[model samples]
Target: MSKNSIQIFDTTLRDGEQVPGCKLNTEQKLRIAKQLDLLGVDVIEAGFPMSSPGDFKSVEAISKLVKNATVCALTRANKKDIEVAAKALKHAKKPRIHTGIGTSDSHIIHKFNTTREKVIERAIEAVSYAKTFVDDVEFYAEDAGRTDNDFLAKVCEAVIEAGATVLNIPDTTGYCLPNEYGAKIKYLVDHVKGIENVIISCHCHNDLGMATANAIAGIQNGARQIECTINGIGERAGNTALEEVVMILKQHSNMNLDTNVNTKLLNYTSQLVQQSMGMYVQPNKAIVGENAFAHSSGIHQDGVIKNRETYEIINPEDVGVSKSSIILTARSGRAALAYRAKNVGYDLTKIELDVLYPEFLKYADTQKEVNDQDLHQLLSSKDNFKKSVNF
Candidate 1:
């Protein structure tokens, strides 16, 4: 991988589908796998094969279908889970088995009723066992966000020595701030022996609404891969949004990082996942949201109309949005009103616009943003214009 190239590891089918009521069937998972491939994600975490027979088949089917991206299966750090995942990915063009155990003290003592040493042993053994099935093995230190950095570095070193090709440092509970997360990844890079030979991947949750921020910080600190989901759908609040991270890198060339993601497919991919998972992307959500490119404030609408760069850092077409929307609300100005009018087949002169502006405002106050149909009604009605004072 190039030093500035970031790998987009999409966990939508595995982590995203784990949301309650969002579980996808085998065929549905396959459909999303195909889309993720088309979107140029570097790795597709297809499913947790050991979770269910349905999931096993879904992973197996996706493995057979995906031709470009590496098809990966998630598993616990154990023989049974690893074996099942390997078997499911048997036919993949490029296959990976992602297996790991929790590294945080809370997960070790309470969740597993084990000691730190025992957790390390399990992680090493799991990665070594997985390496036997496939040359590509990723070891995740679950809940590493809260794990002691020194101990986390130790675990990462042991796994890399044990033949792990990728080391995933996950903020599994979304517990770390951006600075903390970046420091954690930087510590691993500096302290973990043989770290340069393997990829450092970040998997972050959004409990505090900082998953994307944390992931970016990870890359800035040397992590090379981001594990994210389409539409940010995942457990709890959600995972890091794929579109958010990709566009961030694209927009801020100063970051000096780029991903394989074909950004034009981002909107379509988000929509497909939203529909498949029965989840809605909030209007103000970043990147692929409905309002991401819509300008409504008078100042914003005018700036966007004159030059999109004034208000928009990203072009609507860059992410497959047909065009930037200049919504005509009561807050909109004459410039936006005239822009919309021309689109719907009317060209209002400045004098004519001044005449229609107040009536447009009166009608817009009664509703949300004025749509083309509403504008037509306001423009074509002689009675409505009759009330307007001549300008």
Candidate 2:
């Protein structure tokens, strides 16, 4: 892959499942794993194998099902977790073990009650042990976002020396600003020895609503892998959204960055994960939301009606949406009314539209939106416009 090509590490089945009440069975995991491979993600973080018997089964099933993407299993910095993960991924065509420990001062002092020197030793040991089972070992520094840049660099250098092929620097609590996160990654790139041999990965959370922004910033600073989930679902607020990051790189061609993702399948994949997990995506969420391509405001509706590009940066069809919706609301303009009227088979002239506009507004004001049936009723009430109504 080119240096500009970013690897998409989808953790929808792992971190995304961590959302309360959004657990998936082994069968559901296999289905989603196949779809992730079809969606062209470079790596699929299947699950934390040592967490539960069911999760281990799901990871094993996904490993056997996925044909292309590298199947990765998460593990703590211990021999037992790594061994369990290895056994679960035994059938994988390409398997990866993701292992690490806390590196931040808060975690070192309070969470683990250990010293920085011990944390480094554990990180190196985990990566080295994981390397024995799989050639591809990804080492994460838990809470790396808050870990001192110099200490983080030292840990990264140590892990790389121990055969870590990928370095995941996660904003575990979603604490860092975009600039701060970018600077952290840059500090590692410039400070860590033997860094050129490993891929720098960004795994951000959305607690501060900066996960996607921070991921982009990390990319700008030289990280090449983005760990994300579909619809941005994960612990707390969520992780960086797969569709958001993929589209950002595609939309900003000048960034000279690209991913192997199949953009057309983004909406399909989002819905699939939503249905499988029983999680409802917010109406206004970006990319895959119900309202992403829906226009209701008068000015915006008119602009979108005139030309889709006037309001939409992404083509609805490009993301698997059949078309844009011009929802008829009290805020809708004459252009929007005419456009929707034409779609339901009524081509109203200026005189007919002028006659029907007030009646339509009266009905629209009383309801949230004026559907085709409501439009038909409104047009039928106007004696002069009644003759032009299609139905």
Candidate 3:
């Protein structure tokens, strides 16, 4: 891996499918998995093999189909789950068994009904057991965002020592602010023994709409891997979006991080997931959204027309948008009106445009937006004008 290259650990099939109405069949999972492999993600978390037979089959099929990316199967920190995940990944060229347990006090006391020492023991034992199946094992500290730093460091150190190749610190409930999440990752990097040997991964949720921010903070602090999904689809308000994080690193080169993702395929991948899962990406969602590069306001359209960089940070083609859209609404300026007119096979001069602008506004006021046909009619009306009589 390059010194500044971040590893994209995509969990779309496992986590993204957890949405209530987004369940996908094994064939759909395989299709998305193939696209993800081409998209250049480092690891594809196929599914939790122990969850059900259908999940196991999805993992197995994805393991067989994916050629470039490592196929990973999720598991609980226990014997049965680890065994099932190993079986599901038996045919993978590069296979990983991702197993972990809850680390936070709330999860330990309420969710597991176990003590802290016992939880740590289970974590170590799970990693050691998983190492027997495959050399690559990822240990997740579920809900580590709220876990005490000292205890979290202890668990990280123990897992790294026990043959785990990756340590995942998840903001399970999206409770931490960016500063807080960065501090947590920094603490683990400073305090955990043998931490430099393993990859530090960040898995964040979007309950507070900060998943992308928190993921960036983690990378800036110390994390090298981001566990994200297409369109940020996942359990409970979704997870960090792969498109947003990748583009953020690309646009803000000052961050000094890069991912292997072929950014041009981002929009295509998002659309595939949306169509397969039957959950539409919100029109205003970031990065791959319909309005992501669309300019409608007069000031914004004028700035974009003059120079796209004035208002748009990233190029539409950079993410497979083909071209930016200048939507003609009541608020659209004359520049946008002319721009759209030229595209529609009309070249109106300033004099003709000045005559047409008022009528355009009047028509725009009566509708939501002015389409090409609408603009054509407005221009045609002027062409049919009769000569003025000077008698």
How large an RMSD does model 2 have?
A: 0.9
TM-score of each: 0.97, 0.99, 0.97
> What is the C-alpha lDDT profile of model 2 across 253-275, one tens digit per residue?
99999999999999999999999
| Highest lDDT model number | 2
Clashing residue pair totals per candidate (backbone < 3 A): 0, 0, 0
Give the per-residue Cα lDDT of candidate 3 at 153: 93
Off by over 4 Å in 3: 383-391
lDDT of 2 at 239: 97
**Candidate 1: tens digits of C-alpha lDDT, residues 114-228:** 9999999999999999999999999999999999999999999999999999999999999899999999999998998999999999999999999999999999999999999
Minimum summed lDDT over a 10-residue window in model 2 is located at 382-391
Q: What's model 1's lDDT at 168?
A: 95
Better of 1 and 2 by TM-score: 2
Between candidates 2 and 3, which one is better according to lDDT? 2
